[model samples]
Target chain A: MERWIISFCIIAIEVWGAVYFFDIFMERKRKGWLDKGRYMILYLATVLVALLDMYQDTMVIKVLVAVLELMAFCAVFYKAELKQCIFFSMLNYSLLFLTDIFSLLIENILNSKDELYALENPFWLVPMKMVRVFLLIVLRWIWKGKNSYGALSYKEWRKFGMVPVFTFVSMLVMYFCYSGEKKVQAAYLFLSAGLIAMNFLVMVLMQDILEKGELLRESALTDQKKESQLSHYRDMQALYERQGRKMHDYKNQIRTIQVLLKEGDTQAAAGLAERLTESIFVEMSAVNTNHAVVNAVLNQKFHVARGQGISMIFRVGDMSGMRLDGEETVILLSNLLDNAIHECVKVAGLGRKAVINIKLVEEGGKLIFSVKNPVAKKVQVADSIVLDSGGGMHGVGLMNVKAVVDKYGGDFAISCDQEKFQAVVML
Target chain B: MKIAICDDREDDRGALKALLEAYGQDFEIREYGSGESLCKDMDYIRECGIVFLDINMDGMDGLEVARQIKSECPKVHIVLVTAYVNYALDGYKVKASRFLLKDDLEQTLQECMDDILREILQEERVMEFGFVEGNVRLKVDDIIYIETNKHKNVFYTQEQTFNIYKKMDELEEDLKEMGFVRIHQSFLINMKYIERISSYVMVLTTGKEISVPKSRYSEVKRQYTLFKGVE
Candidate 1:
């Protein structure tokens, strides 16, 4: 009855911890924090731990709680922040190791191994065996989680750093506690079962995540291709229609001026002509071109550049209607134009000039598309289009052009002299 | 001789018409706006000695209008008028009689009208890059062919003259705007330079030739565009 009451007290404390965990987690959530729910579950699992202690001489529940606790620690940090997480994990492990050594020293100094064992000592072998089982589950749990999740979170991996330390200390304590006449056999079967399950779970999750990532990348490529194709046809029709409308407006301006002149109002005719000409100059080439993707891309980039007061000259001289298909033309021109416009607009406040020049010419059987822009800022290029000073997204347009050029067996190169950034594509 | 000017911008069209009227003594001028308007019930191209066209008109680019006018009546001269300098090349490829830049429209219009009169008198001379003996000179006209070997660039003229190279770039640089291309690494040949350009070699009009590099031959042909492309 005394044992049952003590067990009830332990279970009650564990249940309270389990319930309070939700409040801790939910409060954090309201402040925008993440919890993997492992902690609350492990605390509740401690109730099972107490009940298991009452029934079996085995340390299964203690080991299982350690396993779950280690997992809670791992989920605390994101995957791939490996070096930092591992460094802190080792620091915690060292502290546990020192405590373990100190505990062994005290046990040896007391010199009371046998009597302590039979007296239901805290360092006794049943608990020692339970601690050992717990650590095994902990190690396996951390390893399984780390490999699958791209390393355990800071907390969990740190718990792992404590593993060898906890083992050393627990082993010393076990030596002290199991020095009596009877020594309980360890639960070897559960250790094997636990690690096996963890390994299997890790394999399945890793495979699932990788496969999903691959599928997502391919889907994005196909979606971009379809959008580009549609943009091509749409661009041609829009350019044709806009220029058509502009011509009609031009004709009316002349007729209106002519009518005013015929009425002998010479001043009105001249005034009307001046207004029409001013409007024409300002709205010139706002009309879309023959390739939709290129048109949309250039129009957006042009607006972005114009707003910044960077002078831009984007003109297609002659494709000869045979140099490139609509799709290739759009991809090449859009990427080139976007990069030139972007760099041109980024420079600020200098007698320093900001200008973007793009020219396409057919020479020696190659279609040469050149983009040159001036920047006050220096650009540093790394492997894979990384700019030292900006987000990786700055190079995506160039990469898009590179991908197409490589597909077509063309040459693309970037060179800079003075403030000029030049990218040349030859196909 | 009669001439026509068509454009969507009234000022551009009117200014060009006035400039031509001031200089064109023997030419009668007709004006139209929009390609569709010109295409409907107008034989202005057939009656005119030349037509001044604008590429940015509302319904048709000056290029398309040139193409249609030439298709209908190839003998009519075409002078493309545009405020933008970029469209000048399209005028030539479309077989325009001349490209008139509006920034210098007054001077260019008179020169263009004079060229039309010269073409009528059968005394017109196109631009050319030439080499005479040791010196590379660009003849304004009368160049028959140009050839280059490993050591020297050569130019042949209408008088059967041969000029050798001082610098390959002299021809390319002096006549770069006049349409001389670097067709081969060893040879910067003019369009008037080649009698026949094949997969293997470029035969010059002077009976001298340069072998086209295997890598750059196709590119040379594509840029020169003496023949229609597969596409």
Candidate 2:
């Protein structure tokens, strides 16, 4: 009964350790203790795995069952792709096998006893279990905050999944071949330790590569967005030039109207004047903020907003005090307005004419820039940080804005309610 | 409403006056040929609700006059009128409420006037509440947010907090049309004072932070966004 209790305790710790290991790397599908059903299933699975470990003498069969149970638990509990769940399950089982081997090797070295005898003795088993749990905890601590697992694609997972599959197969083969031996050698223990270390290094390197890839992709997308915005600005400039030509024609038309008035053709003069005024008013109203870059970005975004059936209102005040240069202004304003436009476009429907309000004003020696737009969904913010809703470039755009704001030693803030989202930057 | 139109050219001033009259609103219109003359009449500058200044005036340009008037009476809305759009940056520097192209005056003046009138009306709105001390009149714009504490609803403004025996639902119903948003059950915030809303918390212009419940977050945000767009 005592031995059964110890085995259950060891299995409980091992199951919990695996859960902790995967939990660090992957996001939970549902959080909090309120998820009692999933938690109950997980607990029952762990107990079943513990009972199987006691009844089953074959190490390979026991590990396989435990791994399958873990994979099942992960599938139900984690918000990850199928490939990721499988890879994490396999990797976790391999690590558990390695720690078990390490603990057995240590016990053998301390007692100089046969491996079977070390396994059967309660004195050896309890300390070995403690050592195994300790190693697992240390390994978990190393990967505590790294959660780049979700970013890995299926292809990447397949490539990285090879390491653990190889390790698991090799460890099982080694255990089967060497378990029949009288005593475990110290050299074999060193080999298993080296294998464990290699696994740790590979995972750390994989996470680093994944993070760097994500950064590269985000920056590349930002560059592409900037290129598109600049082209949009050029198109707006062409439109402005066309308007300038029209203005010249209006001048001639004015001259004609004045000539008509001089000729006492009052009716014809008024008719021409009315036509000119109407045509000019029908043209796109140019947003003229004396700052050339600000005017370009705002006008381009305004045109884009209008194209999407959304209205953009600008309430700009003294921009001379704004510390941003041409490039910074374009990045900051375009990203902000683009984010606003993106959100507004989502909710622009019948009876709801989405509107974006862009405000740039200098107050009390600080340049305050803000954008407000109607939100169709709830925005999650935790501890003042805006959490990305995922699946869109909105988060990346805001990050770029935040980067520019930070570069200028400015304050960037985001606030949202059920209907609206607002981003504010103070420089 | 008292309207001041300052332009160096008499023709532009007369044209603006004609447009103002055509709008059919009761406007006490005053015209100045130059920025200097407009600046000289401090009493008129202080009393007027809106000032239309021409940016290309000969002596003391519109931007300079706007800066002076803004310094003297910050409440007065200055609309900068310029033939060239390039002077818009300078207009922003003087904190002009609106910038109108001299060429597009006929098209934009009515819209500009409507916006200014709405703002002026919002600013002038006042409500009297029975406080613990007595009935006190409060400018609707001055109340930043209202918080329900126990049986009393506390009104927070920039200067002071007024504790009154009032229901939040009743106040929300009354102030619904006046730019006040019910962000939370306990908090009815004035949209004018909202600096930003982040992480389910509303931060005011005066740096007071109020927590917004997750369920009502999206609705509150939408209302705030609409309020800002209208403003």
Candidate 3:
């Protein structure tokens, strides 16, 4: 096993170098390189090697490495645009299978190590290696154009991958038959074919399923974040609005006091109105929240509720001491409210109107927030991203909710019965 | 000062109300929801020395209302308010006091209102006419030919051509004297900027060639001619 480490290290370096060299070329070729993570996988190849080696020789290490490889496998499978995955992850894999064939051939031809060395001589691989590199360059062209870098279904992977798997298996079986190594030839062939097929098939299916699970976990998190942001924005909006209303209120009070003084009741009403204005000022200043844009968005959302004739109540929490920035607060609140408002506005046909209730409270080391609106229609779960598992304005605002939830240590969930569309999040 | 307003759209009527509240304040404001609203009630608008009416409306248009107002309420001044300026020539028939564009509300409206009020409301002065030296000593209204050369405003009347150094926009502003508008960036002729406008070319009155920018073609024509309907 230790003797294999040197070759593994050399292969690891070669694979990583080629991957990064291509990555640099891609980055130089495209402007939207940050959002385009096609080249990012090449870097991840290095990460895979190091991550796999983090725990070595133990079953736990083996499992962890396999899991890491599985993640990379999922990335390669789903990211269909970078068609170079075969030349990259499965790089020496095909060659190793071919070597299995060659080793059998040499064992029959000559018993010495020199014959094996001749087979591995790099000069002998002109056609195969050239085909691989040419394929890589073509795939790079596809990746550079960034056309559907990752949107492959399990079916698509199987369709494209069958030829390589069959060729490799044929060569391996021929080698095994020649090497006199058939124990359960039928079972071996079945299991080998099945394992390879399942490796590709199950990986795609599980990647889709796991990505969805991670997505759900993520969405649950962002839902909570969105709630917190909604409350934060709402609280800030309420503060600003109250301050604005106070200006009108305080001015009228002063006018009343002046009238009272003019009417010779200066001793009576002036004191009372003056005290009232002071109390109003105290209330306004106490709500010294830190956000203007979020306040505006929440205020607009509230106005939307008003225009829709829905009874939307906001329970604004004290977000003054909290650390969510203004822009994030705005984005989260806007998206959450937009989704909730859409649902709220849809609440009809039940011979009843809609009601949207927002509550924000901090409890037990978590920011607990809830937005419950009566939905007229039954809630249906959205379509899962079977191929491109990460994002888009897909299925629901679940991706957005998940992204934001993951930002903060939070949780998001929605339970919709016939009458109520309820979403609760904790951050 | 008195001014009458006419429009046919409920939303446009509301928008005009808001615009007037924001811009027009001085003269006692008379808002007629339609031309007939004021046409049926001309006696009510008789004191409104200036009439502002729209070209396209559900009922009677500004032209009919203006013709009627000129005959029925003789002393009441007529100012045409329209999205299209081509109504200006029809305005000449009823002796319209001024042409105000509704689209250019802030600058054009403010200036037009000021001019209308100055000449008719306070009754301080009337329209300013220009004198161009030529064989006939033509008034600016008669001589529709003015050409620009290097930095000078060259005059081409029915009889003579004289050059003067004046930029187009400035000259157009000053030529409130002769009701001149900056129709083209380079040419500032009086309401007489076009010789003949067609599917392609706008032949200038001066025999000079100019491209009528698509955005300004309808506006310039409406401001200068009667515009019965589009060709």
Candidate 4:
């Protein structure tokens, strides 16, 4: 009866350790924890299975129960896509499975040496049980806070040394189980511990590399954005210089007109004025926002809107005090206005002429930017990018605006209904 | 009122003198044929209520003369007179009160002097703030931005920086009308000073780069756009 009680108590302790470690591994809180009743039910069931396995003395039942427990744990605790949850659960269970194998191997080694004498001795189980508890506690501590298991992509999770570590631990477990000599058992246990430690080190290294990769990707994206903005600025500069030359020519033409007037050639002066105005028609299209870059972008967008037969109402309030990188300003305005124009164009077929209203204003020390356009069809937010029925990567322009807005620590709000879509960015 | 007209060409100065005289305004008008002579007569330049400076001058340009006159007497209004309208933008950088094209000399000059006369009769738009040495008065137009460095609030202009002991919020209230924006915790930039902004960085007219916090970037950009847009 005492021996049965001792085994039952050990089963309870083992189940408790597994449940506690699972909570830490998944970064679940103890108080106000998710699905508390389910966890309790699972814990009771796991303990029952463990107790039954101990009585039946079957290794198959033990492994099967562990896998079932893992599935239940993942379902109740993990909030992620089914595939990602399963992947995370597999990682957690693999460690638990290896710990079980190590415990079983220690027991087998002792039993072989003393003809099942050590099995009867309660003291002989101390080292094996201690190792299990120590491994769990260390794992719980290492994965104490929220592990970013959900954030990682499938490729990242796979490439981050999970498969190799699992294989290495499995091979060590097999070797330890087979090597049952008295002296070799302790050595095998230490070797397995060393290998597990090395696996953890590799995990840390993989995480670091993953973070660095993400950083590099982000910087590269910014660089690409900067390049595009600069090209736009260059295009605008060329146009501006051309306009400047025309302005100079207009002055010289005025001088010619003055000379013609002095020579009593009023008809010739009138003809020159008409020709001069016609020649500078393109130059007259340029928006005067006081900032050259903004003026260029606005003019470009204006021409685009005009080409599409979309009525573009672009109003810019005092922006002289504002200075933004030519590239960034171009990217932000071009993308935003482009998106607005694209939406307006899509809905043009819906009987009404498309129109977009863009306002760049300041109030309360904040620059208020707002763009409004009628929606062509239903809008869907996919991958955090707002998309209309007129699909493709058309939403990329708005996404670029969002990226720039986010970088500048600005507020970007989008309000879309069946009829109208408005995006406001306040910096 | 004392008026100083500095032009490199004798004919241009004579034309300016004739125009100012035709306006029939009772004033003492001093003409400098070159920027060097205008800069040399510091006493007359200091005492003048308004200075009409020709931009293209030999032996020190009008911009340099204006800079020297500004440092000595910031209260004195400097009007940039040039043939090219394009040069008006450059004139604005130096805080020139008005840009008068030589072609419309009489009308532009009369308008500028009339505005100055009205301002003289009204309140001065100068903001006086306490600095390290003492209280210094600055024309609202001359200020580029006010920034916080450690504990000091540094006022940036086109030519110089003035360090003062003042809170950002307090200074903001006083300078908001003058088109100053607080871009970051440590930065209150004059919207006029912004030459370029991208990502988290803003380039001032002086070629100094200012880091903008991501959270306040849109705010800074919007404010700047509005300031530039309205005028």
User: Considering summed lDDT, which 10 consecutive residues are worst modelled in model 3 chain A?
Assistant: A382-391
TM-score for every candidate vs. truth? 0.36, 0.53, 0.30, 0.46
Winner on DockQ (1 vs 2): 2
The number of clashing residue pairs in model 1 is 16
Summarize candidate 3's per-residue lDDT along B109-221 as a digit string, tens digits.
54445445554533333323332342333345545655577766776655656665656565576556354545556666555445555443566656766666554554554
Which segments of candidate 4 are over 4 A away from where they belong? A1-79, A111-209, A248-293, A300-311, A320-331, A334-359, A363-366, A370-409, A413-424, B1-231
Q: Could you give the CAPRI-style class of model 2?
A: incorrect
Displacement of residue B20 (Cα, Å) in model 1 is 32
Local lDDT at A58 for model 4: 51
Residues B63-165 of candidate 1 have per-residue lDDT tens digits of 9988988898887777777655445456656877655546556534554455367655432334434344433434544555455665776555666656564
Candidate 3 residue lDDT tens string, A147-235:
23233455555554664455555644553343333434334434444443443443344345545655665676567556656665665
Q: TM-score for model 4?
A: 0.46
Candidate 2, residues B52-162, lDDT tens digits: the string is 999877779888899999999999999888765555566777878877767667655766777789889889998899999789999999998899999999998889999
TM-score: which candidate is best? 2
- Those runs of model 2 whose alpha carbons end farther than 4 Å from true positions after fitting are A1-97, A106-202, A225-229, A232-236, A266-285, A343-346, A349-351, A376-395, A415-418, B1-231
- Give the range of the ten consecutive residues with the poorest summed lDDT in model 2 chain B: B222-231
Ranking by DockQ: 2, 1, 4, 3
**Which predicted model would earn the best DockQ?**
2
Q: Tell me, what's the RMSD of every candidate? A: 21.3, 10.0, 23.8, 16.5
Error of 2 at A238 (Å): 2.4
Q: Model 3, stretches more than 4 Å misplaced?
A: A1-99, A109-155, A158-294, A349-353, A374-398, A414-421, B1-231
Off by over 4 Å in 1: A1-211, A222-252, A264-308, A313-317, A321-323, A348-352, A376-380, A387-396, A414-420, B1-82, B85-231
Give the Cα lDDT of each candidate: 0.53, 0.75, 0.52, 0.66
